[model samples]
Target: MYAYTALGGPEVETFLDLPIPEPGPGQVLIRVRAAGVNPVDWKKRTGYRPAGAPVPEVPAVFGGEAAGVVERVGEGVTDLAPGDEVFGQTVTGGYAEYALLPAALTARRPPVVSFEDAATLPIAAATAHDALVQLDLPPGSTLLIIGAGGGVGVAAAQIARRHDLTVIGTASPAKKDFVESLEVVPVEYGEGVADRVRAAAPQGIDAILDLVGGDELETLAALLADRTKLVSAADRATVARLGGAPVERARTRAVLEQVAAWVADGLLNPRVVEVFTLAEARQALRRVEDGHARGKVVITVPA
Candidate 1:
């Protein structure tokens, strides 16, 4: 087995002949076909976590989202068996040829979904679903999404639109066209982001989904008509201190199962901007850490 491990600092090393992980009780062993790279993946590698827990063992397999076929099942795992195609988020060990997933967080991949697309669903889509639904947004209400061109942003846009809300999203000039193609009104994110959103939505925004924190937090707060409706998945602590809602998903198998169905029905689509091989894992993490990816970046493992 070959896996990408974060040995600390900015280094990601590829280790050949890494030991294959075994399934524990209530877990399944998956032969990873594709792994999705997220901001959190790189952030964790760089020793970033809000909870401030001790780092996992050095050379920790660094991946959160993965899609693959089940190779074996552990004790008490009855819902899945060998050869079933599935995808989900793992606490660790997804960057390897084989990884273990608790049965509670794993779901069958939809028939119409590909490994690349299925790999992107677990984290971003589930987070978006949690944020929007938590706001209790009314149909036809106006909603604004900050950083709307990225993986989570695109998912939020489509999900909100599906609920009959007038969706407005912000993206860089380079990604404006791509954002607009998702049926969202794309505004350029910059000095006049609020003004641009106000121009498109005269009555003020009913809710805001803020993906980028920092200075944008103040700007997003200023645009909220109902402060309680402002939600952020990335900055839960800040959102709580600022009197806004903090969004989080349960990461359960049932929730991801619904997401898989959306992918199958063509109701949800994850944009894969780039794909790298296992050996190029460093470059994949670099792209995500630089914040240049228009969507998800995936690492494909050769069979």
Candidate 2:
């Protein structure tokens, strides 16, 4: 199997040949067809380990979600069998041609969903759904989505529209048009952003879903009268201090299936904006790391 792996920390990713890993009990081995590229992929490559997460062994593969046909099923896994077309959160890494997925988290891919589209749902789309569900905002209320040009932002904006909420989004100037197409009032993020949002929504924002962290999270927090409605997928501590909560993800197969259903019904768009081959994984990571991609980036592994 070929994968883009790191030796230790955030360094140059190199394509290497590695032995295929066998699935453990309750796991399944997938012949990866496509893998989604996310901010966490680059963050992990650049030495951003999640809190209390163990250090990955040397030459660790990069990626968290993928879609492909099942090559084999681990012991006690009866829901899926060999040759099942599946997609979901991966066990270790999804960048390789063959990756392991815990059977519990994986779901059967719908025949209508493309491999590239299904690949984008497990992490970004699922998180968006979870955040919206957490907010539980009523229809016709205003919901603000920070980092609205990225994958999660796009998904959240679309889903928020389905809920009949007025949507405002923050993004770099580059994504202005993309944000507008989602029917979200686009606000440029930077100095004086709070005033911009206020001007955009004179009635005021009812809730916030933040994907970017730092002082900006604090800035957005002030827009709402009830700070309890604030949620951040980045910077948990800062959000907590401001009376906001971190996005609580369901991370279940059911969540993935729901996201797919939304897509199939034309209510959600993953908006996969870029696709790269396994050998071009570094370039794929670069697009996401620089924060320029308008939507999701994916890597396609040849059969």
Candidate 3:
């Protein structure tokens, strides 16, 4: 199997022919049909490891979420069997022809949902759903999202709108039109972001979800009356200091099932603006790493 994986740190990531990984206990292997490209895929190569992620064994594949048909199941995994169409976080890196997924974290992909769309739900859509559930705001309340043009932010904005919350999102000027299309009040992130957010939400923000952390998150924090509602997915330590916590991700199959259902029912769209073949995975990674993608970018693997 061919895998686009990290051969070394920084600039050494490349594609290579590798052995197909076997599923361990409570895991399943799938013939990857589509893998969602995310910023973390590239960041991991730069030595920015997320907590609990296994240390990269040379040639570590470059993706986390994937959608495909099950090929094999490990011991203790029974709910899913061979031929099941499923999507979830990968245990064997998703940027390959085949990958392993923890069975408990995987969910069936609805027939109405395409592999490209299902691939985006495991991480982006699931995080958005988790963030909103953490905020727990009611209808008619105003919710402000920082960095709303990226994959998770875009999902959060649309899902918030659907739940009857007035949504305001911040993104680059280039994404203003696209952000507005999601029915979110678009605020350009820049020198005067605070002013723009204040102007957009005169009723005061009921809660805030921050995807772009750092000084920008600090700037937005000042505008909120209740700091407790502030949630950050980027800088956990910083958010903790600001009296806010990181987005408590559910990371469960049930969450994936819910988001997949939303996509299948047309209630939520991952808005996959770009699709690349596995051979073109570099271009796909570049698009997300360069912060140029307005929505989700996916890499498709052929049967």
TM-score of candidate 2 relative to the true fold: 0.96
Give candidate 2 regions above 4 Å deviation: 1-10
Model 3 TM-score (2 dp):
0.96
Model 2: per-residue Cα lDDT over 211-270, one tens digit each: 998988888888788977999887788988999999998989999999999888888889
lDDT minimum window of 10 residues, candidate 1: 1-10
Clashing pairs in 1: none
Candidate 3: worst 10 consecutive residues by lDDT? 1-10
> How far out, in Å, is residue 129 in model 1?
1.4
Better of 1 and 2 by lDDT: 2
Q: Model 3: per-residue lDDT, tens digit, 1-303?
A: 334355444367677888888899999999999999988788777766656767777667789999999999999998999999999999878889999999999999999999999999988999999999999998999999999999999899989998899999999989999999999999989899999988998878989999988999988898877888999988787788889999998999899999998898899989999999999888888899899999999999998
TM-score of each predicted structure versus truth: 0.93, 0.96, 0.96
Name the candidate, 1 or 2, with the larger TM-score value.
2
